[model samples]
Target: MPLTFIDIERQKNWRIVLFFLVLMALYLLAAALFFAALLPGPLSAEPRFWVFLVIAAALTASIHFWFSASNAVDTVVRRLNAQPPDLKDDVHRMFANIIQELHVVTGAKRNIRCAVIPSLSLNALAAADLKGNAVIAITEGLLSRLSRPQVEAVVAHEAHHILSGDCLETTVAASIFGTFSSAMEKVRYSSSNRLFASPAFLLAWVLLQLGYLVNLFISREREYRADAAAVRMTRNPLALAETLHFLSRGWRGAGFIGSGFEMLCIVNPVATTLDETEGFLPDLLSTHPPIKKRLEILLQMARVSITELDANAERRSGRKGTDAQERYFVMSPARLWQGPFTAGELDALPWLSPLTWVANGKGKTAERAWKDPLLNTIFLRRLAGDGRIESGFTCPVCKQPLVTAAYEGTQIVQCGFCAGTLVENGRIPRIIARTGRERPCTERLNALARSVLQQNQARNIYRKVAARGAGQVPLLPCPKCKNPMFRGFYSTAHLIEVDRCSNCGLTWFDQDELEMLQCLIENRLLPDITVAVKD
Candidate 1:
């Protein structure tokens, strides 16, 4: 018979009890050893001493366990700097909605709160405390990038952990010893040389090792149970499978998620060799089952092979099968009609602009390049590069005077108010090539660049699949020509959207978009195609 939530919850109670008993035993052993070292005699023969030690150990263990586990949810929230989802933000709003839906679906069995961790790493964790508090926290990077269904799958997976009572157990275990480990890490990094030889430091180190005992109790199989429960709850095994594949390849918050908390996460934040291997030792020691095995199970339930899933994911990452074969004729600077050229050839022409008259072929009516929707994107690409010269142009978005700014040794007009930039078509290549010389890309900028690229790639895939463009934002007029600029991706390959003026040969990037573009090119960050494809 399939296990229900009630059945899972009941079975977990014994495990939690066992954890407490084991914790008391560890404390008793430690106390007995400490007394033996101090007294210089065997205390095992003394019944009164044994009784006193037992009582003291039980009291100490009770205090330690309660203090650590009672406020675990709050402790985790503070440590992660997680905040409640902002209702005003679209992505955060969607997350909040999913939590509400979860509450309804689960019959409000527990009041589970939702939070968003500000880090850009992809990971999510659940925490529950003895105070009846439960929270599902997802990193901003993961939350912003996943589809609605994928997010649903992740949330359900976490929810199952909370409802099954394992989250509480894990939180308690982590709190009991993980707290000391975290403190020791800080002390080890920040303390003086003398502190390393201190007795307190040695005690903390021993406690840190004892924390690993908690991991022994944290069966890797619980993750499989959660995956199955998530599927049962969401009825979308494929979504969960895709999410796992994505997480397995991407950054999973290794340095940021903290140690001793891996058991609480959907995927082990730190991907260890043991977590990916299957053996009696790994099965006994690891906190998460192998991702490949988890994916196999989920894919089987979804009734699809790993190959088909990978292909679908590839398409979603904006990998096209074939390039479009449209050709065009152009009106040259000398006013003579040029022969039919591919879009690539048209882009190479220096004089091509919105006002340039162009024809499709023999009988097609001649029209301005800007009027041809397909050819207009060529101008947008032209604007993506860097250029300098003050033409007394005002910012399209901020209405402030544009200042000539030197970026990568080239001149570009930038808005002092909004920090947006206007670059001419000719300077983009120079700017891209000159990146990382004077201005090295910071880790924050690189992360942002990858995130923006992934978002645009997903948007592009959606546009192609739906056969429609995304909802249009208000168009910005050209600072020079006063004509509305064309808004679109820089190119199919780059996928960074920018506004270009076909008339004036200009492009505008809002705020950090220009920097993100440069960083992307410098780092060669591509769409997330590293999805695991193990059988």
Candidate 2:
């Protein structure tokens, strides 16, 4: 177990910096208003005063609600904390059983612990910095409502998280959240009346909106990674699917349940995108993908029959495989895309070169992408910049960074700061060459898209072929096969590492490793045509 107590203090400084920046900006705004009072008398009574007052009143209402919600923990802790921290009985023991099962199956470390909240809200989550220190928390609601398999399914998912180093990742995230939450409490809720009257209340509100948005982006990736890990560990994908099905119908609450972690209770608060008839925001602020999609993925992974499953997947995607046997590779976005690639290709992708002020990977990850282009605005900066990204590291064997590139798309890559892929093991080439028909990942992409879209999807969503720095791969452990990585020469030209895990059977690769793998397949089928074709 590692000491991963939330970095509560450091997080607070960030909140303080944000608070002061907001306060200073507001101070300057007030000073400008005072100076404006010295402006023409006619302008003084311009209805902007009324508008500002209205905004202040709205701010007061918002602050009041914020204050009220902050006390929720007192009630929750008072109720939940008083009970023995651990649940007793078959349901409580179920998590332990699941953890034990995972340890035996995955050879994961033991000493895992479990806690149950008395509520039957169908929620289960994991926390801790290391295997021995990890804690799995489940709602009493989930235990009462779900089947044994369903409960174990959720536990297995959490077990994979603990094994995959998510505990440490989350400990870090919690530190940030804890600091922000604490500072927010100090600035906006010291007293109900004082908070309502102060402009800092409104300022804090704005800051929270932004902070949560940023947090959601990071959190979602970890969730998917956890899901992928679970599938590998248990090979019981339907456990998760079954669990989610039960969860969507979990405890129904009256009225609006506020946003954020509370909303992320395994089962998310149901929301539909706003249309002309209903008022709702897009899913961008959402903490997780729609429950429907999550289940769809698990159900696919739980395929009792891979051939039938792949066929169904293909139909849903509305196209036969471009090649009889091929799967697309994986991707992770660059810091919003000055992209991570070998340095030599940087010149051709000028827009991709993080050199210009506008596109430089900056801000949230200065060490990752350098200074943010938006933050360092000089008129000429956007036009010419080399997106120097020294952070947001990726695995040397994968050459891909962890990222969330779109609201609907899975968190795949655009690039990374440091990346490596060992293809010497036969797995990379085999993974690329093999059709997921034998082992599909979330149903074929094309099949799912077409079924959902009610039309045939675009041609070859996967890239064709890719190369970097003289077309070479290094020797390392295979990301997919876990064997000594093998570098295979595809056709006569394309070469790639078998980038996948052998133990769990999940594949790993950056961007179009699939396409390069695919191109090799195609060139083998049509060797004469390829030489005739030009880039």
Candidate 3:
């Protein structure tokens, strides 16, 4: 309330309240003007004039009530086509836990409901009713891409929306805009059906546009407030800033939530070029702050420079403690477990066997030894000798045999026919990092990929592919665990569809997808564990 955001100089929380009051007065004036224009010439009696004024008042009041009392939360959820999350599902459970933790931090009394949109878009929308019922709906893309801290930061941001009463205000404003827009639509329809048109319809249409703009302005203010509140609550403006920056890389899912519901989301679903002009005019009209501006303000709040943030990220990305030699146990050729050697010792062992099993930790048995992901990957690579593990199965897309190959020190499987690569779940960050360092985009693939996946063009491609049933591809079994894989877009930005195995967390990428992702990573557009998460 006291200018919580560190950078803003003039605006205060009360200014938003004052602005809403002015908007309300403007709405009333517009209603009066609408009715006055509709009046039939000079009224003979004062009572007749009063009647016209009363009718106009009633119409405006009806719209306000229609939106406010009409089960807004449910309407919003339905508009997004979101479903109640299944607690049994791992992703769903993670979301539920994050929301619960945020709720606890905020200490809000009202229970907040959560849902999943089943969308691959990386965004979250918050909505609430006048009665304090609130809900937050998250897209699957967020769960798939963002790390726990980043996600926690995002959930905290939405939670603050609920706590600070932004959801109710924004919801009411959205409802009013929608109702007025619908009224204008009916008027247009009537004009088309009529033999003669009325001039008042033009005035009504203009007024509705003004009303929607006012709602947009208020929504933007609410976003800033929520951002500040979230930082205050979580003490991690860097995470939210990184998240916003990451999301701005390419956000084309606004159409999925529809134009009417776009304002409810954390970031504008509409993808704007990172190079878009930034000034008072654009910021005044936008539903959310410019992504660059938001990042700058957040960085200011964190009291750290972008260089510091990057350095911290690099530090976090260092090798995990498993690299140490004190925890590994290898089996000898005589079938007896050897000393608790380090990872280096195990790697340097004289006789590593396909039959020989190695485990980490003191109590780990041979049965559970393979459960360690690092160990499993290392053992598998060693077993293959030449770093090619045959899957004994053919690629569904190309019908060629799949074999794991070592690339950039990571074991990834590639199909012989299409040359598509299949990578284990936790290995993506490593692959991206190594690829960025070693195979930096020498060609202008960054420019090419960006042009190909430009916001508008990418959005159109998504719509066409989604419409033609191209987004739904047949599933392929996991090469390691043999579990059924789920198919989805890798990122809405790149529009590269992939199949991911939930059981083993492995991702299969078609040939073109691997190339496309290499470009994205080289351009520093991809999310990695060291910078944003721990895998």
Candidate 4:
């Protein structure tokens, strides 16, 4: 058996630590320059004075920030826009359980705080402060998209970082870098044009540049070790390998999790537009190893060839028939039955939702085929729910299934087809309260809104959506009961309206409307739409 990551050579670890210390010295050198510029002529001229200044500054910063680890962890959690996982929520509960299991396996008694970023971006990362407060945060996409095994793989990887003290080092390095960055920014924009008078900013920039490569290299090595450690803990290298492949394939264009923190994440949070070719420059600069290389290593560890693994995965999913022989049908957006395509063909569709009605080879409806234990396991995983069984409820607009999702303290049903959300009965209060009570992440909300609007505009539905506000939209039947739903304003302050089932006490928010509602609540703004006047 190959040696586990935890038992890796100590000499290599010491070498990395030495490199980090060297980087720290360079940072102090840079800070010395900044102090020299800030001080008077004679004092600045004395090299001993500059050295003392840098030491004092470094000590002050380290003492101020490092002593209170909770504050550092809290700052990071807030920066990443993370919230504590609701233990009552199935997904959140499962995530918490995974961390607990990893802790038990590693014999780590330090309580690992768990949080979730309300992002659809598929990423997970670990962070720790000098005083030992540690946090593990995963995105909403990870819970919604990945399987339990995959989630465990991710959690286990993060656990390794925490256990091996990587997260502690990361936090300290980031703090040092951040201090320099703030100083640089202040000096760069200063009104005084004392040409090169403040070499501190210049020195800070140089330290950042030199440290970048070393940091990237060390981060990449840590990732490999984490991968190995996760595999050992999960006893499933294939799951981690598949996760890497899935994440690489699902790369949504960058700026999801924010930059400068990519080194801490399992995968680089910032998406690169550069077409990464087989080259040294990409590998050297990347904070994580190439996906292909990681996959290959995992496959080697699993003792399975690529072809074998692919075949095994298919067999495990119970998908055996060829495209020519099997007949799988799907309901089109027009409510027309379009089919006789094979499972492979059906899978090729870009917009396959759990709400999508699919028929098997025997012409059995998805509802009926879903009863089969074997078929349910395989097909449901490919669907939006990820094989986790959900209570059945149809989307009133698209006439598709809805999945239960826990938001804050309330449980709401989300339409897998239309991307709408339904809050039933007294749940609306909880939903509204959650939004109203908390301080909003204004920048995050704005970025999210901009991204959503850009996507809608790209689809040419921006005009139609804007016009939707001006017209008396026809009422649709309630998803819960077939009663006519009433359209009314969501709040007294906002002009935006939502559909509510009077009888069933259900409120329906259309696609992207939930986000808009949150924004309205955050900013206390009225409807942003303009009415089109006609002659």
Maximum-TM-score candidate = 1
- Judged by TM-score relative to the true structure, which candidate is superior, 1 or 4? 1
Q: Rank the candidates by lDDT, best first.
A: 1, 4, 3, 2
Candidate 1 vs candidate 4: the lDDT winner is: 1
Between the candidate structures 1 and 2, which one is better when assessed by TM-score? 1
Model 4 lDDT, residue 205, Cα: 64
TM-score per candidate: 0.57, 0.37, 0.50, 0.52
Rate residue 142 of model 3 by lDDT.
Answer: 78
Task: Pick out the ten consecutive residues of candidate 1 with the lowest summed lDDT.
Answer: 31-40
Give the alpha carbon lDDT tens digit for every residue of 56-139 in model 4: 868764564454343667767887789999998999999989888876775566678899988887888888875678899988
- State the TM-score for model 4: 0.52
lDDT of 1 by residue, 85-126 (tens): 999999999999999999888778789999999999999999
Where does candidate 1 clash, by residue pair? 382-425, 385-428, 386-427, 386-428, 387-411, 388-411
Residues 1-535 of candidate 2 have per-residue lDDT tens digits of 2211122111222443453344334433332333333233443366886467446544643453344333433333233331323435776666667766766665443456666666545576555442235566677767766667767777766765565554434343343344445545664445566445545455545554555544333344445656665666566786667666656655532122223334324444443332112113334455555666566667667654435544554474465433232211112245343344332333344333222322222223322222433222321243224343322433433233323222112222323322222232344445445544343433344333223222111111111332223224455454333465333323233333334444644344444445444444433322222232223
- On the 0 to 100 scale, the lDDT of residue 445 in model 2 is 41
| Model 3 weakest 10-residue run by lDDT | 526-535
C-alpha local distance difference test of each model = 0.81, 0.44, 0.67, 0.67
- Candidate ranking (TM-score, best to worst): 1, 4, 3, 2
